[model samples]
Target chain A: MKLVCSKANLLNGVQIVSKAVPSKTTMSILECILVDTTNGEIKLTANDMELGIETTIEGQIVEKGIIALDAKIFLEIVRKLPDSDITIETDASFKTVITCEKAKFTIIGKSGEDFSYLPAVERDDSIVISQFTLKELVRQTIFSISDNDNNKLMTGELFDINGDEFKIVSLDGHRISIRKIQMKNSYAPKKVVVPGKTLNEVSKILPGDADSDVTISFTEKHIVFEFDKTVVVSRLIEGEYFKIDQMLSSDYETKVKVNKKEFLSCIDRATLLVKEGDKKPIIVNITDNGMELKINSALGSMNEEIDIQKQGKDLMIGFNPKFLIDALRVIDDEEVDLYMVNPKAPCFIKNVEESYIYLILPVNFTTVA
Target chain B: MKLVCSKANLLNGVQIVSKAVPSKTTMSILECILVDTTNGEIKLTANDMELGIETTIEGQIVEKGIIALDAKIFLEIVRKLPDSDITIETDASFKTVITCEKAKFTIIGKSGEDFSYLPAVERDDSIVISQFTLKELVRQTIFSISDNDNNKLMTGELFDINGDEFKIVSLDGHRISIRKIQMKNSYAPKKVVVPGKTLNEVSKILPGDADSDVTISFTEKHIVFEFDKTVVVSRLIEGEYFKIDQMLSSDYETKVKVNKKEFLSCIDRATLLVKEGDKKPIIVNITDNGMELKINSALGSMNEEIDIQKQGKDLMIGFNPKFLIDALRVIDDEEVDLYMVNPKAPCFIKNVEESYIYLILPVNFTTVA
Candidate 1:
């Protein structure tokens, strides 16, 4: 294969596909990216069995052929090359020669036939969605997904699609986050669990300011997303996701509104006293004067009281400070409301005027003095 | 101890002394900072058996006493507290109470008597030098210090003071870096070795914009540096330092002057082909046309030729790219001259007009094919 392309264009294309290449794989071919030169474009494809990425860029093609080269080495070379046109050609023995300015690289290429082909999705089964909405949805719910490999089902975000609105839910049993985004139009209703790793990769590659739409499709075991010049496919986890809606509490006796930034900083300071091996529980006590946050551990004890605009009955609850901090950071409002049902029951945190809700299970701190 | 001080002042004082506190020490008192409130000032001190640091800050002293608290916890609390007056007091049972606005912390403290006393340096034997000059001397040669504990002399920078000029040299067998700074006043000549770790801590606490002078004293087994509000003492490393000047060649048959940034970037790009387990050697071949750099490993191979204004015989030398990069980065010049005695000998690298010199030994390579 022979082609000539701009350094910037080639670097961007290589970066998108390099993310899908496995760093350490048992199969040697999985570490290589398949490069094909055709009519007026060059296509790059990389996959690691579980995830696959393909991207195409405009280039001048001198010949039509295909070769597989080491993904990381190729990307680094292209990124460092001077800003000029890069020429690549494959010899009869499949040894690829890349030239840019005075630099020349001779990389041994493998047979492209050994690379696993990415499965194609039917055009009729795809659904159209704005890139902005999809990006926001993934950012809001992806962080709450479980990272444990043993619980495979909980490691992915659950997407429930119905009519013109969709709900995304993620939970690790201790904490759960749910967000709903309104879609442009109604389509065939469906439900699928997308792995957190795949969604994270898609978010990074998506363009920020482009108004163009994205197409998404899913089968029984796989899901595919296609943008302007890139396609990403990931395997779905096969199991039932937790019933997050049932775990959310329905009623609360006290509701307090506090500034998000102030509340977040307070919780962060309180966590400093929570030892790593000990149960990192921060006790939140609300009284007529204000709210007091305290953390007691073998290391030391820390407490802070912030003035609040409330006169509710005195109540104290304990929770993992890290969970509360994480949930509070995701809320995009100046003021957030904390809904409490009882001292030991789960508490709901959300924006004062929005439908978004985050539930965190309280920790049992009776054993600690 | 009872005192009230500005949050910013307390934070700065804690940060400087905290660097001397050992994270893991056999004696628990070594992990705490001794706070003594007397004569309208609070003194903070920390030591790790080999190095000691003490700083004093002005405060409103309500009571004169002494206590030792965990350095890490105290620093964290000071960093997060609001920008206001912070009140600190020690109870009769040695529990330190720190209050800032509405926040409170009850940290467990130990008796100040348990802390080790810092050594005192005689004022008449000290040499005065600008803080800026000392900071510059440390940065230029510290990177060449050996990290191996077995070679105690090579793990520290040799400081040679004579009259009004100060010279610092460091070597790690393969490479050597030397820097010299001229002082204004004359003092007794002295020679001592300062551990790299102590210099690193001193660098962190030095103010970037301070123009004040620092007093430095060297004894038989210890070195002391005193500034406006802080004093640092470090134990000296013993043993004779190797004569690194003999390693540099006097005559060069071939030389080339090139842009420092351009050469650094080219070497960085060439090193990408080096694999982890491989020898990781990059070859530099200089000819009339230019200099060609190449690296061949199990991962891949890369070659780049940079144009230079030279007409010399072709020469090929291999060296670890990281060592060359580190040497090149420390030279404070736009263009650097490289002198080579032969293909296998150590090469001398220096600025065209500066007195600083860097020597890098070449790696032996077996040519294949």
Candidate 2:
């Protein structure tokens, strides 16, 4: 295989596919990216069994052939080469040579047949959404996904689509985050649980501007997102997702509106006093005058009072400060409304717009005053 | 103790002393910073047995007393507080209370008497030097200090002072870096080995562009640095430093002068082709035409030719690209000269002014054709 392409174009293309390549895998061929040169273009494909990424770039194809080269090494070499036309060629023995300016790289390549075949999306049902909106939705809910293996279903974000509106929910028992976005185009209703790791890669590769639309397709086993000349396919978790909506409280006896930035900063300061090994819970006391947050641990104890628009009697609750900070950081609102039915019940956090809601279960602090 | 000080001033003072506080120490008092409020100044001191740092700041001292509080917690609280007057007080039971605006913190404090006593420096043996020059000298030589525990003597920089000239040398067997600076004032000749950790703390805490001079004093067991309102004392590492001058070769058969920026950039690019676990070494071959750098690893191989002003016979040398880049970065001169005697011998790198010199040993290549 022989082809000539711009250094920047080649670097971007290889970077997108290399993200799906596992750094250390049992199968040696899985670390290589399959490069195909045909019909005036070069296609790069990489997969880690569960997820796969493929990207294509315009290039001058002198010969049509395929070779598999180390994804990370190839990407790094292409990225460092000075901006110029890079010439890539593969010999009959599958030794790939990349040359640009005064720099040349010779990588031992495996046969393309050695690489596992990536599955293609066969579902006719596809949804088109703005790249920026989809990226934002993923970022908002992905952080709450469980990192533990005990609850396999909680390790992925649940996506529920209805008409033009799409909602993503993520929870880890202690805290839950839900985000909603309005899609420009409508499609058949579908539900799938995308792994948090896959969504993370998508957010990084997806462009910011809405200049292009992301086409999403899903089957029973896998879901795929195609955009910006790249495709990301991820396997769906095979288990029944928890009913996150049911965990949210329906009624609240006390409510308060607080500035998001001020609240976030206060919680961050309070977390400094929370011990790591022990339960790092911060007490939130809502009174008629204002709201006070306090944390006590071996390190020290801190108390901060923030002015708030409170409605109802005074109440106090204890929860993890990190959870509240994470939820507040992802919310796209200037002010957030916090609701609590009682001191022992779960607290609901939502922006004034009421588009997204976050529920955090309070820690039992009955022994502590 | 009771005092009120500006948030910015308190934060800066706490951060400087916290650098000396041990993170995980067997002695609990070593992790705390002793705070003393008297008259109109607040003093903060922290020590890790070997090194100690103390600083005083002007504040409104209402009551004169002393207390010791956890260094990490105090710094975090001060950093998060808004820019305002912070009020700190100690109760009869030795509990420290800190209040800033609407934020309050209560930390368990030990008696100031429990803190380690910092040694006093004799002012008669102190010499003053420009902060900028000292900082530059430390930056150039510190990277070469040995990190291995087996060689205790090589784990520090040898500071040799004669009259108004001061030279610092550091080496870890494979590489050596030396920096020399001329001070405005003359002082008695002194030789001391200052631990790398101490120099690192001094570099981080010392303010740049401050016209105030830094006083340096050394004794048989300790070295002390005093500036403005801060003083740092560190224990000396006793042993004979390596004879760095003898390591310099008398004659070099080949030499090359290249732009510092261009050379550094080329070395950085070559490093990308090096793998982590494998013996990833880049070989530099100097010919009458130009210089070619090549590296081959499990991932791939890269070869790049850069134009340079060269003389004498052609020579090839293999060295770690990362070490080459690090040494080149310290040279302040626009152009750097590379001196080599043979492919297997160490290479000498120095600037045109010859104020600093770096020697990097060549790596043995397994596949040299």
Candidate 3:
């Protein structure tokens, strides 16, 4: 097998697929990237049993064959090579030789037949959406996915589609984040739970240009993402996601409208009183004047105030600062409306259009000297 | 005590002195930064026995008093405060109040009397040099200082002051690095060993302006650096440094002049053949045509060739790639001359001016298939 590719394209292709190559595994073959030209295309594929990635680079394939090279070593070699055409040739014994300009590298390769390829998923039910919308949806809601393993379903996010409106929801018991967007075309309704890890990897590889689009196709057990000449197949989590509809109610007795940037900065400053790993909650008091945030930890006590427009009763509540900060940071609105029932109830940050909603449960407030 | 200071100035002063505050210490006072205003200046001081730093910030002192606050908390609070005037006041009971704009923080403080202050150093013998020169000298040679504690003397760099010529030498048994610069004013001949840790901190705090000057004073046991309203006192290493003058010889059987950037990048690329913590040596073969570099490791083998102007007989030598990279990265020259004797002898990279010299020991090379 022989192929010649530009250094930039080859590096980008390897980096996109190398993310799925397991660093340490009982099966060493999972550490290699298969370079296959049997289909007349220079395709690089890597799979770690759960998540798999395949990317095709712009190259000239002189011979139609296949070989597998160590992903890490290949990545390093390509990274350091000069910005020119790199020629890779493999002999019958799987001795791979790579040359670029005046530099040459020789390494042992494995038979392509021994490599694991991505499981094929039927593409008839693909849901097309702009890459920018998909990236924003994942970024806005993926953070609320639970990181613990006690609840298997909580580690993945629920993607529910109804006609042209697609909604993504992620919850970790303490908070629930939802982002809803409209697709250009209507499609069949479907629901699937995707692991947070896969969404994170897809988000990184997906371009943020609004003009480009990504087609997402899924089956009962596998989901496929096709974007920018690359395909990602991920094993879907098998279970029913938590029903958060009852917990996501927008009923409230107190409402306030505040500037997003000012409110975010106030909470951020209050967080400085607590150290890492500390779960100290920040207390918020809403009145006719403004919104006041306070926090007391072993290190110190902080108080911050910001002007807000209030439309209901005055109230005080306590919440984990990080939960609010996470939601506020991804919000693009200049002013956000916060709805709360009482001190012990959940607070919702949402708009009238229901484009994005973040609900956070309050912790018990205890004033300290 | 009460003082008003700009948020920027206070943050900078705290950050500069907080480097001396011990993160983990049995004495709690060592974790605090002493704010002293008795001398009509807002000075922040932190001492960890081995090193001490004190810097004065531009602030209006309303009252004269002293107090010590937790360094970590103080630094974080100042960092998040708005860019405006910040007023800090301490009561008799050591209750500190910090306020800026609409943000306020209250924290507990300890008595300033309990804080450890910097040890007194004689200021009679002093050496003045441009901050840029000192910074450059340290950056060029500090990489060769031994990190192992087994050899205490090797962990420090020797500062040999002879009239106007100031030479700094660092060696880690495998290689030696020497950087010499001429000072604007001649000083009394003196020799001392400064711990690498102290020099690293000093280098970070020192500005890189060629116009600014730093006054360095040393006694039998202590070294004091005063610059830009800041004073850093460190305990000098008590021992004799390694004798590397004999190894820094100019005699050679083969000489080659190559582009510093090209040679550095080639060695850097060859480094990709070995993983981190692997002591792989790159073999260099020089002849009338050019220079050839080769490396073989468990992963693969790489070969690179570069054009060069040779002046002596052909030679093949092997040396640690990192040692060569360190020197080549710091040298500011278009072309660097390399002197080699044989495969087992040391290789010298120096110029006729003798302003800088780097001597690297050769490693045994075995031909690999």
Candidate 4:
């Protein structure tokens, strides 16, 4: 295999594909990046069985061939090399030589035939979406997904599509987050549960530009995200997601509109008394004079007051400060409305148009001193 | 105690003094910061027996008293509070209340009598120097100081003051780095060894601007640094330093000058093949054309050619790339001259006026295939 590429172009391609490379693996071939200069394009591919990424970088291919090199070493060499034309050539024995300006490196590579290729899937069931929206959806909800595998269904997010309305829901046992956006066209209803790890990685690599679009195609066991010159494919989680429709409701005994920034800041300050990993609840007492957030822990006691416009009956409840801060941080609106049924029930926060809804179960704090 | 102060000013004082507060200790008072307002100033102090720090914060003292609070909690509370006038008050029971705008915190504090005070040190011996110069000197040579306490003297830098010329030297057996700067006036000769940990902490808090100045005073067992309403006192490491004057030689069998940046880059790229914690040597072969740097390891082999001006007979040598990188990274010169005696001898790098000198020992690599 022979190729001449600029340092900048090659480095970009390597960084994108490296996200799919497993840090530690029993099979040596799984840690290698397949560099193929066949079919008139220079493509780099990395597959870890569960997730695979590939991209074609701009380069002048002198000879059409294939070879697999250690991703870690190749990346470091390319990143530290001077910004000049880099020539990469490999012989039949897999002895590769990389030269750039006055620096040269000679390393051994494995045959590309030993690498595992991404599993093929049909792309007929496709949906087009904006990259900006997809990134926002993933960032705003990925945190609510369970990190452990105790409940396999909760480790992934449910992507529900029905006609022009599309929504993504993620829930741990404690809370559920839903983001809904309008589609450009109506289509048949479809549902798929995507592993949280895949969406997390995809979100990191996706560019936040409104104009660029990504075509997403899903099969029975696989899903693909195509944007720009890169394609990310991952296996879908095989399980039935929870039916959360009954959990999300518009009924409320008390509601209040508070400044988003002020509420987030208040909760953040109240949490200063709560030690990390401790579930000390932040008690919210709403009266005629806005609201007062309080927390008492082993460290100390803190109380923060925030002015808000209250409606309906006044109520006092306790919640995990982290859940409130997480939802409030991603909200761009100046003011947000929160509804509550009672002190023991879950708190609901949503917009008037139903774009996004956050439900957090209140923690019991009756035994506190 | 009762006082009102701006969050910004109080936080700055807390941060500086908190550095001396030990993270973990059996005596809880060592982890607390003493706040004293009795002398018409809001003074904060922290002492860990080995080192002590104190700084006076700007505040309006409404009541004269004293108390000690946990450094970690106080710092966090001040950092997250709103940028408003913060009022801190304590009663006879040591129940401290800190209020800022609409937020308030109630915590327990210890009696000020339990806090350890900084020891009195005679300040008869003093030297004034630019803060910018002191910071730069510490940064350039501190990397060479030994981290382990196996050899007590190697863990500190030798500060030798001879009249108007002052020099500091640090060595870790493998390499010796020396930095010298001229003083404004001549004084009595004095020598001391400051602990690397002290210098490192001092550098972090020192302002890099050229206009500021710092007063340094050394005693038999302790050293003091006073600047900008803050004082840092640390215990000095005792023992005799190594005699390295004989190693700083001017005679050479082969000499060469190369672009500092290009040479550094070449060596950095060559070290990519060396695994972490592995001692791989970069071989240098100098002749008429210039120099060739080569490295062969289990991963790969790399050879780079750099142009230089030769002044003597050809020579070949091998060195640990890290030693070269450390010196080159700190030197702010466009071109550097290297003087070598033989393949097994050390390399000397210095300026015409001997402002700074770096000596790196060559390694034996004749047995490698």
Which candidate, 1 or 3, has the higher TM-score?
A: 3
Instruction: Give the candidate order by descending TM-score.
Output: 4, 3, 1, 2
TM-score of chain B of each: 0.95, 0.96, 0.98, 0.97
Off by over 4 Å in 4: A367-369, B367-369
- Sorted into a CAPRI-style docking class, model 1 comes out as medium
Off by over 4 Å in 1: A210-212, A311-313, A352-354, A367-369, B311-314, B352-354
Which residue segments of model 3 deviate by more than 4 Å? none
Q: Interface RMSD value for candidate 3, one decimal? A: 0.9
Cα lDDT tens digits for candidate 4, A253-354: 889999999899888888988888988999999898889999999998998899999988888898999999988987889999999989989899999998
What are the per-residue Cα lDDT tens digits for candidate 1 across B1-369?
789999998999999999999878888999999998754579999999899999998778899999998898889989988899999999888998899888888888999988897887555677877787778778878888999987899899998888987778898988888787678887778878899999989988988444788888878888888887999999999877777656766688778877788889888777777766666788888888788888887766778877665534568888989889988887778888888877778888876444688888899877656
> What clash pairs does model 4 have?
none
**Residue-level lDDT for B192 in candidate 4:** 91
Show model 2 residue runs off by greater than 4 Å.
A238-250, A367-369, B210-212, B277-281
In model 3, residue pairs whose N, Cα or C atoms come closer than 3 Å (at least 3 residues apart or on different chains), thus clashing, are: none
- Candidate number with the higher TM-score (1 or 4): 4
Ranking by DockQ: 3, 4, 2, 1
The residue-by-residue lDDT of candidate 2 on B251-292, one tens digit each, is 789999888887787777777766565657888889998999
| Candidate 3 CAPRI classification by DockQ | high
- Judged by DockQ cut-offs, the docking class of candidate 4 is medium
